[model samples]
Target: MQILANIIPYFISQVENFSRRERISFAYLSIENVLGFSKSDCILKNDFKINKKDIKSLINIVNQLKKNVPIQYIFEETIFYNLKFKLNKSTLIPRNETEELVKWVLQYKFNSLFDIGTGSGCIPISIAKNSNSIISALDISLDALEIAKINAMYHNVKVDFICDDIFSYIPKRKYDIIISNPPYVLKSEKVFMSKHVLDHEPHSALFVDDSNPIIFYERIIKLSSDYLNDNGMLFFEINEKYSGDIIKILSKYNFVDIELKKDINDRDRMIKAVMK
Candidate 1:
């Protein structure tokens, strides 16, 4: 039998790659995930005994953390929009900035929605959990779509998950809202990203060619014109560096009421345009 307090120090000592702060966060997250002990529980009941089997599981989690594996992938689930979403190496971990995008989308009223590049189906599924909407999502990877399907089923939300390349797939129906958090990170920007993301997450869901960074944006915007109903809305989680370019593309497509929104980090990470 090991006490919670003893196990945390062992995690800090074993996971040498993370910073002190990250190690601490990993410690708390691991303890809670393995033992169902909240941070307060860990502090107040510091003497809480962790049995040998649970301690072994926590050690395995810590070893994976040392390799810069994201805790979400290690746990195979994460909280998005206050809902638990299942994940795997096939899917990118959902970001808080995406939650901001969902919040912005929910501020409007719409009956039908479509999500492009719906990794883990977080975007459309989160919306489905919150609203009475006909939601559909598409992804290029069958593995990713399978994970998305599991997540939608787990949440008991109805989302039509399609496996198809967006650049080639033609829309079969129009939607009241077309939203995407497409891959917008430039290959050049990879140098700035953390090792955990670069090493663990799917590249197709993250990086874009530097010469054509907004390729996904262009295709989605072009398709939106045909797939959106009159006065329908298009929302994107954008790369701030390409915000100006995206705005130009939207304007060229005759989209109106275009707006760029900053995330909590104050980066221009989300944008919206209305079909004209």
Candidate 2:
């Protein structure tokens, strides 16, 4: 008879190279995925014996974790605004700061909405689930748009997903609200990010030239005048360092009621401007 190996010790050893938080997360995900157990079940059965057949697969997952592959991509999904979004190497994983931006918009009502750089369709899909709004989402990468479309369909939200470069693209119909979380990270700022992001995530989705950190902002703001209805609103998730610069650009475009808001970390992360 084969001896059943105890789960806890092996799980700990496999995730030893990870951080404390990562260790916990990897263990939780592994046990849940392998055993079809919930987080609560993971704890309750921490000592549960595992089938030796599963050990090799768990080791592979742990090795990937050791290499700093983001669990979201490895799992091929992530939760955004309490909704599931399928992930891919081509799209940026939606962040909590974005969820805060979504929450801020949910406080106001709008009939038509447009999302710029809709990587995973997280922004528009989340809003569509809660609000009955006509939403349009655009991405520069067709590969990213494919993943976004999958997410939109999975959520059963009707969004007009477009694949085009926003720098040259123009909208035919004006929208009541425009929102974007464009590529704000500067090339010089790559040192500040983790290996998982810098190595695995799409650079086109994460970075812009340092000389023009807000290049996308400039293009989108200039294009906004043509696509925003009277009294329309524009919202942005900005790099904290460029918050003031973004506000000035919006003001230069004659947008009024400009406000800069911070995320939970107290970093300036959001800005809102209204058409006069």
Candidate number with greatest lDDT: 1
Error of 2 at 106 (Å): 0.6
**Model 1 misplacement above 4 A:** none
- Residue pairs in steric clash, candidate 2? none
**What Cα-based lDDT does every candidate model obtain?**
0.92, 0.86
What are the per-model C-alpha RMSD values against the true structure?
A: 1.4, 2.1
- List model 1 lDDT by residue over 104-185, tens digit each: 9999999999999998999998899889999999999999999999988888989988899999999889999999999988
Per-residue accuracy of model 2 over 132-232 as CA lDDT, tens digit each = 99999999999999999999889888999999999889897999999999998889888887788898999999889988999999988888867899999
Worst 10 residues of 1 by lDDT: 1-10
Clashes of each: 0, 0
Q: What TM-score against the true fold does each predicted structure earn?
A: 0.96, 0.94
Residue 18 shift from truth in candidate 2, angstroms: 3.0
